[model samples]
Target: MNHASLDDFLKHGTATLAKGPVALIFVEDAVELDSTLRHHLQCGFKAVVALMPPAFELADDLEDTVHRVAFDCSHPQAVFDAVNRVIEAAPGVWLYYGYNAEYLFFPFCETRSIGEMLAFHTEERRDAMLTYVIDLYADDLENCPSAVSLERAHLDRAGYYALARPDPGNHNHPKERQLDFFGGLRWRFEEHIPAPSRRIDRIALFRAKPGLRLRSDHTFSDEEYNTYACPWHHNLTAAICSFRTAKALKANPGSTFDIDTFRWRKSVPFEWHSRQLLDLGLMEPGQWF
Candidate 1:
């Protein structure tokens, strides 16, 4: 069902937000929007909320399946704003957010439903799951100028690393169980990407509660929600295989002319399986077996 605007959705369509495990997909552009939605829907989310511009068209079936909200994705803090509002309205619900061309993959996701993984996480007392935004791009940009192609998607097999996240209020000490992850196309082509936007780590899957806020940095207002794991054990992590970075880099005029292809020696074909991400150490299974 399509709502006239975000406010209209909040007022009339919020009944869809009554359940848990809702996916809030922010459509920045029309690129792979249908595939992105279908992926999350297949993950067994209770609801999939598509916050997109009214101009963008959705597949007939998707229009019937997802709760569509007209939103201006280009506005500053658009993602954070929309997500936080949903959080406020759906306290105690599981929430996940991503952009177009981004696919979420958790350990054993091929056979296990996302609900099963979140159930395990909830039992472990984890309110959020860390997800690395693994950059995906077409092997050749000449034919696929947008740098996107699900059939020919490739990602960096290496170059991913993490640094201790510092606590500014505590004499710059590293935050416990928290690290600022970086890599993928953002790190490879840093000249064109802004420093603040380089980190690929995001607490994408989370449980909403009163006063919970998604920060501009993709972290959360609640400190614990930003942690990568519990103090006792390593927690489950997920990966968002995305073409957003590659699309942006190739779309931007400054970087567009400078690159002919996104492939490098380290680039490998994305197998589109959770095991591949696990083998590459992009995500962890934690205690779930």
Candidate 2:
């Protein structure tokens, strides 16, 4: 069901949230909406909610499987409000949120469903999972003018780095277990990206509680939920292979002229498998086999 606002959807569209993990895909543009839905459905999310512009059209095939919500993605707070409301309505349920053209990958995701991975995560007493937003761009911009192509996607094999996340309210003591991740398109084309959005670290997967809030920075109101791992060992991690940034950079008329192409020497074709991200250290397998 389509809701005019996030409040309307939270009040009405979350009846099935408790059944299993839910993926809230916010669509900034029309590119790859069908593939995004198909990927999440395959990942075992009980409900896949698509929040897009009023003019956006979902594929005919997704009419029955995916839920549609009318939203203005330009307002970042809209996403946070929707997630917080859903979590409040169904505490302890797993939820994931991302933009269109972003695909999730976990270790052994080939043979295992996301449900199985979350089950393992729950056993370790973890509420949130760290996800790296690894940027993916088309190999030939001319052939794939939109800067997106599932078949010819490429990602950076190296150059990813991180620094301590600062706590501005606390005189830079630094937030525990949180860091600012940077790499890929954003790093290569830093001039075009806003400073606040450069970090690729996202607590994309989490078990929601009633009072929890997803902050504008993509971190949760509860500090522990922002951690990279548990106390004893590293918990499982996921990779969101995405073309969101590349798509934005190329679409912006101001930046388009400067960016001849997204490809660089470090770039390599994405293998479209969990093993590729694992070998690149983008995501962790943890204790799961």
Candidate 3:
């Protein structure tokens, strides 16, 4: 059911908050909304909460399973507010957040459920999961003008790189166990992308807790949660195959004429599996059987 605002939805819509491993999909646009919801559901999330504008209609196929909430996603704090409130309401629950065109893939995600992954994560004494926002674009944008087609999706196999993340308080020292990742469409079209928003590393999966806050840069207020890995070993890192950046670049008037093709020599067709992402070093799986 739809609520008037984020607050309204958090208060009324989430009657079954105790259900763990909820996927909050904040839809900035309606494109691929159905597929995004379907992917999360198939991954065995107990609930898939979709936050979208009031008028945007969810596909009929999703009405039975997906929870629809009415909220504007344009505001900077819109996603953060909803997530923080949900975390407050349901502490200790596994939570994940992403956009419409993004799909989450953990190690062996083809066979394992998100709940299983979180269970393993909890055993490792971790509260969050690091996710790489791997850009996926239509190989042939001519046929699919939206710049997103799963059948013809392509990604840069080798453009991925990382740099030391600066500490928020002091630029002199780098943040421990944290690195700013860059690549994919955002890196390829750096001229069009603002410098501040280039990093694609996000703590997309986490356990909800009191006083926890999701920052604008996709980091968390609690420093430990923002860490890339545990003390002894790297944690399982998920990949969000997304067409959001590609779609935005193609849609934007400023960049449309300049970008004749998103593909370069390094571009390769996405295998649409966790193994491909793992092989490319786009994501990591630590001590996960």
lDDT of the structure predicted as candidate 3: 0.88
Q: How many clashes (backbone N, Cα, C below 3 Å) per candidate?
A: 0, 0, 0
Cα lDDT tens digits for candidate 2, 129-232: 99999999999989988899999999999999999988988999888777789988888888899999898999999998878999888999988899998778
Report the Cα RMSD per candidate. Answer: 0.9, 1.5, 1.4
Against the unseen true structure, what C-alpha lDDT does each candidate score?
0.92, 0.88, 0.88
List pairs with backbone clashes in candidate 3.
none
In model 1, what is the error at residue 195, expressed in angstroms? 0.5
What residue pairs clash in candidate 1, if any at all? none
**Cα lDDT for residue 147, model 3?**
87
Lowest summed lDDT across 10 adjacent residues in model 2 is found at: 11-20
Q: What CA RMSD would candidate 2 show?
A: 1.5
Model 3 segments more than 4 A misplaced: 168-171
Output the lDDT of residue 264, model 2. Answer: 85
Best by TM-score: 1
Say which candidate scores most in lDDT: 1
In TM-score terms, candidate 2 sits at: 0.95
